[model samples]
Target chain A: MTSRLTVVYGVRASASEIKARAQAIAVEQSVEMPLSAIHDGSILSDIVGQVRAIDDRGNGAFDVTIDLAAATIGSDAGQLINMLFGNTSLHDDVVLSSAILPSEMLSAFGGPSHGLSGLRERVGAKGRAMTCSALKPQGLGAEDLGKLAFELTMGGLDFIKDDHGLADQSYSPFVDRVRVCAAAVRKASERTGHPTRYAPSLSGSYTDMERQLGLAREEGLDVALIAPMLAGPSNFSALRRNHPDFAFLAHPTMTGARVSPVLFAQLFRLFGADASIFPNYGGRFGYSLLTCKAIAAGLLGSFGGLAASVPAPAGGMSLDRTPELLDCYGEDVMLLIGGGLLSAPRERLAAEAGRFVRAVADHCYPRLSTP
Target chain B: MTSRLTVVYGVRASASEIKARAQAIAVEQSVEMPLSAIHDGSILSDIVGQVRAIDDRGNGAFDVTIDLAAATIGSDAGQLINMLFGNTSLHDDVVLSSAILPSEMLSAFGGPSHGLSGLRERVGAKGRAMTCSALKPQGLGAEDLGKLAFELTMGGLDFIKDDHGLADQSYSPFVDRVRVCAAAVRKASERTGHPTRYAPSLSGSYTDMERQLGLAREEGLDVALIAPMLAGPSNFSALRRNHPDFAFLAHPTMTGARVSPVLFAQLFRLFGADASIFPNYGGRFGYSLLTCKAIAAGLLGSFGGLAASVPAPAGGMSLDRTPELLDCYGEDVMLLIGGGLLSAPRERLAAEAGRFVRAVADHCYPRLSTP
Candidate 1:
């Protein structure tokens, strides 16, 4: 009656060798001893991960599926992650292409509180994809960054977040920056009567984090940004569990190197990110279009009956690429453009944002009038 | 007066092309825009990262140092990490070799609270190098694990942590395991008059984590294990900050791919681990000897005036390699033996632990009596 996790391992060995390796994995990943060492009455007998099926995927590469006992990982994200690929990550041949955790285990780590639809509802946008951008070049004082946020939000972007680089540095201390930027976004909403969600980067000590989160709430900010890779998945999950009102936008920064894009996106959604941000393909990052599509699919599709999270495609996005991106990801995606907007002349910044919004509008609502 | 980060990037282009790529990195990782677009009063004008030096290392590799305004990252570890190699990590050719954060920034992250001397004092050993082992083979009931802990402690190991596989599974829940393991170590210490610290894996909800730490303390445990890659560096740092008494042992899991062994070890130490644990070369994992040596050096070396953290190398460690492990790591090492000890016949388990401990002691205190 135990639930299992099916993991597809890319192993390099002969058919016979694969069997040996699978047997080794069964021990290595769990008991770390031969079957004889495990006692008769030990619970280890029941909970040991088993290599169920091995399918060859050409040239010494076999898609080894290991069924790990759900009880082994239990409810801990950290332990589950360790079981998934901790020791195996160091091995070159064992690439973890996919992992399907049992529902009982997945539910323990609560998924997004406010998912794609909830986020779209918060943005109050209809018939068009959401546009997200960053206020960047981190050395700015809180006042200056706040001003930029005001301009961008007023210019028609649905979501305005701090750049992944924005942290609690002296130039813009987190408390000060979040306070000012939150205020600025509110002011923009007041003027344009169009609310734009501000997601400040979450970083610093737990006490400091609590204060920052509280401050964002006090300032009426709806969304918060956290680079889950840097902060850890558990921390993010804890935040999502505690704060039901704030939508989380998970940033993929300083972490794309280790995690496969699709897996990262899937975990991001599973860990309660309303918007899972990633470096889009055909952009500055070398992610393939297929990987981006896969990531998008993972975020939007249902797994473990969790709510669908938004797929935020970022990095080198320009107004010109909006239609192609729309064609690629369809309607339920967030187009995050940073450098491209900063490339515009300051006098034309608002106009540039407006153009990007119009560009998205045209693609999504082709027959309808631009609103 | 701004501090800079020195990064060596592995490029796939000519010398001039490397220079250009370095230039691109400066803007891409910081402003994410061309300098021409930045205006007089913009933050990009003042705080944009500068490519200070680019040394051609031949073979399309170059050591490029980018002098970024310290204010760009601020003091948050998450932000500093993001700024250091976030966007660049997505680049296939870009490999980060070393990073020197400003002293102010480094101190803010807070390196190991309980370092080499502190750990040595905690285990009640003045001169001899410490011994550490694991209580693993995950399926064991709390009773067996507790008994095993008692034997290993009596056999003369300083530290005993859980196998990365050991989690809050149904067979052995975390709370129950910690209680049994802690009591066993305490009983062993009572008889042997030697302290053997038990560090259960910290890998669940913050509440569950808090309870585990509390229970460990309640039962007189001194050390706790955390895999920072899975739990997040910030969580580990916060734990170190909050619990000054407990020694933190970091497990390198699910993270070796993104970070170089040396840099990863350095960062682990920087984030407040009393000991940095990683897979050694010639073990089950594929880390090279040179890389393992570098990791050991990183843990032991003085960086930002932080105390030295012990280098605990494990994964397929055995009694035979103890002398070589000691030779490679010198005295400031914790050789983690897992299955090696587990494979020993039930009657000879304690004796096997004693031999391994003697091997380490022989290298460190060659002439000293077995006191």
Candidate 2:
């Protein structure tokens, strides 16, 4: 039977010692190993298996994988995998790496409730590149931010997301912000005969989260951005089950502390995010280039059962870096440039973003493909 | 005028560089300072003045404090404190020390609805020390664990708690386990008249948490144990509002990740915990004796017209160490002995627990000044 894998990185200890610690954590968090299992030197024989790997940098980092018992991890295997990482964090220097769990792998979301083709179809972009930007820096009044968002949509950006920091602050209350931004986007779309979608940040208590979702629906907003850790685990499952019509764009905030370099993609995809936005390789955060590529690959990789999620490489994304990111992450991607687009003059932002997106598409898919 | 204090530890860097980084995090997480604040050097000046003290522990550990702007924190000051620590964590070796925000502390949960004297009155332990122990080592079945709890209660322990690891699992399903244990504790209490109360672990989804609380109430359980972080921020407040009659005992499970030598007592005390349980000094957890003492002092310290909370010291506690812990924490504390009690023979566990409790009482109120 194929089992879920968990890769942990830690200081270089004796192989036996590392194995013992790993087994202890697995038993402590999942199934407890009996005395006989230990005596037989198969303490984790039923629940997990051992793998060999080491960190070359030598800053006390080693990589080891454990095979998860199907019983230990129930139907919600994604959450089980996350719990493995979370529980192991009780120890020192154990960062989560990659995970291979059972789930649908083709559709954009776990099973792409809407894949790239579907999303592009909805946006009326068959084979062309799409430019996205964020309504940023937070603390701005709803009216001010909404106006900026309208200008950007009119200017030609395909997507406009509220900055990850823009939660339910009073300065820009979620309801008012979503209403204003949605109206602006719609107005721009009507004026330009071009469509633009808005994804507002959803980070609040369960009740407040519901209010935000309801407000987005009322205002006819295209997508709702969410950060699971910030919102809480049940919120996502509840939103998916109850509010099936609401499109979700998941942001990585307060989440990196758990998954780190390894199991991020699998967890995010399984969490049921349509498009998972993560910090890029050369960004303000800590994810490495190889790890970033792995995230994209894992998201697009073959999953026997799990749904696929679109990898949105964000953070410190600039026009100059578009080609590099696109080359690394294939055509099935979303280039989220937030602050960089905002800093430029309003007139230049849309054209600059559009040019960068075209360049990325051309470079990644040399032959003339779709839009 | 009391400012929030945050302690950050980092490798030796110029004061200017550290100042810049600290200021940046403050602005990023908190209220954004105006250019005037940055230009007049008021932002940096404020940080400098707010820093009550700085202690550099040569071995890459440093403690520094900052007076936070109240406006930056918003209505939820505790969240602001968490944000302060969360932001600083991106930088290496930075630990949050103590946070002393504006007084309005207990206004949140109205302090401990029932404190030491109240509990004593309710349990009718006017002259005796309260005995307590946790059901532990995890791995055991629910029925078996319930049987042990019965023995401990019959042995005259005042309180029985589930080990922090005891969550909703298949082996010991939460509701069934709670029903059996609560019933057992009741039977034991009836036979002994010691009024042993059971507090089961309440850590999970919001809906499930409500179900757990409801089950506890239906089963005639006295208190509900919670780990706030694992549950979420709004959990305590919601619990208090929904089940005003129930007593909430917050546990420290996913919290050590935040407060190990970083933030100090002031912040945790006011953040909605009526009886905050932390790892004792010289325990397996590595917190210093001084830090433990500080936690106690902070919890019991008066905060802005709010009543004090009982500090419960736990983890790696033993019967032998009871006298020392009692002497250090005094009578107002709740002594939590877990594995030590579990390891003892069933026949002697209660008396051993009672002996430890009596010793604490003898150390604290010796004779009650019968004049």
Q: After TM-score superposition, what is the CA distance of residue B148 in candidate 2 from its true location, in Å?
A: 2.4
Q: lDDT tens string, model 2, B45-141?
A: 4322244444565553445555554433344422453355543443334444455555443454355556555556555666544556787544456
How much lDDT does candidate 2 score?
0.61
How many Å off is the CA of B234 in candidate 1? 2.0
Best by DockQ: 1
Candidate 1 global lDDT: 0.79
Stretch of 10 with least lDDT, candidate 1 chain A: A36-45
TM-scores for all predictions: 0.93, 0.83
- Per residue, candidate 2 scores C-alpha lDDT tens digits across A139-205 of 5668877877887787666678887666665567777888898998899878877678898987645
Residue B317 CA error for candidate 1 (Å)? 0.8
Worst 10 residues of 2 chain A by lDDT: A32-41
**B219-320, model 1: which lDDT tens digit per residue?**
888788887777666667777778888888988876646557688778888888889888888987778999899899989987989989999888877789
Q: Of the native A-B interface contacts, what share survives in model 1?
A: 0.72
